[model samples]
Target: MRLSRFVSAASAFLLTAALALTGSGPAHAAGPVYVALGDSYAAGVGSGSYDDSRGGCYRSLRAYPRLWANAHTPSGFSFTACSGADTTDVIKRQLGPLNASTTLVSITAGGNDAGFVGVMTTCLLNSSSACLRRIDRARDYIENRLPARLDALYDAIGSRAPAARVVVVGYPHFYKLGTSCIGLGASKRRAINDAADLLDTVTAKRAADHGFAFGDVRGTFAGHEICAGPAWLHNLTLPVYESYHPTASGQSGGYLPVFTAAV
Candidate 1:
């Protein structure tokens, strides 16, 4: 009876151990699923060559989301960031079918609403001071509309994926400091950067209120701001065409820390 009981106890212990091992898997056994949402910034408009099939939004496979995906091997990612997307665009198009299984979510929107692209295009047409005025006007529009729109977007995302950790990424400051442009003065670039900062602040606040993370990239681009660093953010260059957006290298560096830290 003793021999039989000893064998049975050992068998039960082995079975329990096996179950525990199988149930408590690795932390990243099934890699996290990330869904990236937003406008041009998130879409990597000027970073790398975009996939033509995905539309003219210029989403590149080498974009930040892809970089994060590669670093975190086996990570599942859905890059649905489109160009010219507004707050409403994210709520209606990006959040559909998202769920608790989604691990991370990031957005870079609101610039389109301020008509930033149009203002930049106009800058090329005339004197820099005139362009600066447009930027100021755009800033006012952003201060008025961006905050409310971002809050609504966050609320909508929360409704869809309550368990997922959302992250709203802020825009980086563009233009060099203490450096005047050949045609445009330093004041013009400074104003544009200032406007970008304001937009970022609004987006960050909205993310915080919604229990989501905010990736602050404003100060990060300080020294490397447009025309400041040897080669970072593009400014009046090919592919970039304007100093407003980030270069591919800048995007990788800017995105790496945030993506790694949040995930």
Candidate 2:
């Protein structure tokens, strides 16, 4: 009788502990079906640990969507977000995994559509005037052309995953101004930051119009941008594609919390 009672007590304790962890820990039992969609930032280019099978998509294991999935253990997760994916790319290629069963979505795009690489290349390799001129042209595209594209992509997502809670994540300011920053000049840094702000504003508005949550990481990245000590974003790294994207810390410490709260 005593042996049976001890075994029962031990079993009850284990069950209670498991229940407590399930209730309070990061992992939830049979959580939402998540589909992550967007650009290099979403694919975790800068965060490294690339999944080679993804080819040039460069999806990283440390990316926020993956980290969130690792923690929450969603029933299903489709990470179709590709490196260098533009809005059109997303609409055409990335929407397949999303469906009526998907419960959560996150995306970061439009930078590529606005000639992110071109502008950055011009800025980093040329004079400040060159950078500003390209920025002006890009801003024109952002203000005039990107809206329709975003609408088209949003419509596609809605049609495919009508029940999903989409979170459109935006870019962060790349520099901390007013300090003597190496690499990029003050004007260049300011212009880059302004462009980031504009992109976020436009993206946020479109996401809001579609009744989606806009996860703005600008505020979260403040004081952690390049030129700030211990920056979460890389500054002109060797891989180059990794440059200007979030590090692993940013994915975990920056993007994850904002995404989690929104979800």
Q: Which segments of model 1 are wrong by more than 4 Å?
A: 1-29, 240-243
lDDT of 1 by residue, 136-237 (tens): 788888888777887788888887778788877778877777775554467666777788878877777778888988888765566787666554567676
lDDT of each: 0.76, 0.91
Report how far residue 115 has shifted in candidate 2, in Å.
0.9
Model 2 score (lDDT): 0.91
Candidate 1 clashing pairs? none
Top candidate on lDDT is 2
Give RMSD (Å) of candidate 1 vs. truth.
Answer: 3.2
**Which 10 residues in a row give candidate 1 its minimum summed lDDT?**
237-246
TM-score result, candidate 2: 0.88
Q: Of the candidates shown, which would achieve the greatest TM-score relative to the real structure?
A: 2
Candidate 2, run of 10 with poorest lDDT: 21-30
